[model samples]
Target: MTKAANFIWYELMTPDPAGAASFYGAVVGWTIAAHNDAAVGGVDYRMIVRGDGGNAGGVLALGADMLAGGARPGWLGYLEVADVDAAIDAIKADGGAVQMPATDLPVGRIAMVSDPQGAHFYIMDPIPPEDAVPGEGGVFSVTEAQHVRWNELATSDPDAAIAFYKKHFGWGQEGEMDMGPLGAYRFLQRGDVMIGAVMPLMEGYPVPVWNFYLGVDDIDRARAAVTANGGTITSEPMEIPGGEYAMNAIDPQGAPIGFVGPRKS
Candidate 1:
């Protein structure tokens, strides 16, 4: 089993790139730029980042081919894998589905996969000589900006999901936290690092889904900024059991996302 590195980038394939970029830029104070080139198969790509050129990410033009194939507008997280081919094989062996076979990128190899329970994520082998810079205005931040600090999988079978991931990614369980009416929260760890958690979706909630946590210094300010832009608040800022605060919001295109910070004691 190979040790997984931190999340490096996040990408979105949406039907309307311009609209999606505008919504995220206004909501998150990102500077959106368009990239058009004959390289990368001659596709039109767009980049989004904070004004400071930190916390950068990307969006792809959700063209007719993608739409015809049933790709919806949503956020996809990219995890650093030691070997892209091995990761894809492990994913398939663990009951996951490979949406896209491994493809080589300028940086490294990448593949999009859905876990056994239907949660989607990406695996990438970073271009060895061209490692991603932390906090470099990208979706997956490390040092300069807050990268994805946490990920949560809301699934019907938490134990099964845990077991599958443990076998596939060498992740270990870190006990469970009480979520009151929401039941217990199961934490997953890799090596000495806590990567994310797994939990049963609240009763009557939607099907299993993956949630990414974006770090922020001030929850209120972030929430306010979200609304001031074209985004809408789906949930008010609330403290979880362990003293962390979070809130949900929809990007201008109605794709949902979350923000978190230290809870006030």
Candidate 2:
């Protein structure tokens, strides 16, 4: 099945990709591979392989030019679409802005865009390899570890944001969980599975952002690894549905990250 409107890839843009490799390798148990693809603009881009040997995403090294140009460490997800150009057009018409013009790569055509509310993400129409199995999805999974488990958005306007995404990406606001004072945590579903949620921007976040959650085997162990490897646990894991725990953190390089798993410890 074509994953239109679904997340097809995840990426990390950090000033220190080497240190990020060590940080994430410890916290998430990912093995970073050295890949020198000159087509990638001569950056030290590395593929992140989970314990299952399948890649979950890539780590992009932020060049000096990027940092000097006001780029900061953050995680960006790629939302797959049927037509990259058409999507860009719609995004603009709907009050969104294009941060980077659509660029074609060997893998597929991609473009960095922000929603009307200013939460940034990518939209791609990937070109699968000849050996790629038909209709198979990678990187983002609902029942896998290491791969991104959920994609959450913290925006200024939850209602308008939901409407904008629904109108453009074919996403459905299936249901919501009440969060009391913080407002409702509206779940965003592509089909039957709940991919993630959208909520009001929390106290310290200030600006709108996208936070992708990485699945782990043990939430406590993952928290331990974060502090051990120079990362900071900003939120303690709280048990969610299915008895799993989720928490937020800031990686050593200042990129915000999240994790979800059982408390085996």
Candidate 2 Cα errors over 4 Å, as ranges: 1-4
lDDT of 2 by residue, 1-265 (tens): 3343778788899888778889988988998776544655656787888988887888888889999998899999988888999989989999999999999887889999999999999988888879875334588887677989988999999999999888888788977889999999999998787899999998998789999999988998999999999999999999998889999999999999999988885
Residue 121 of candidate 1: its Cα lDDT?
85
Displacement of the residue 5 alpha carbon in candidate 1, Å: 4.3
lDDT agreement of model 2 with the native: 0.88
| Model 2 residue-pair collision total | 0
The number of clashing residue pairs in each candidate reads: 6, 0
TM-score of each: 0.83, 0.95
How much does candidate 1 score in TM-score? 0.83
Against the true structure, candidate 1 has what lDDT? 0.71
- Model 1 stretches with alpha carbons more than 4 Å out: 36-39, 128-146, 203-206, 241-244, 262-265
In candidate 1, how many clashes are counted? 6
Best by lDDT: 2
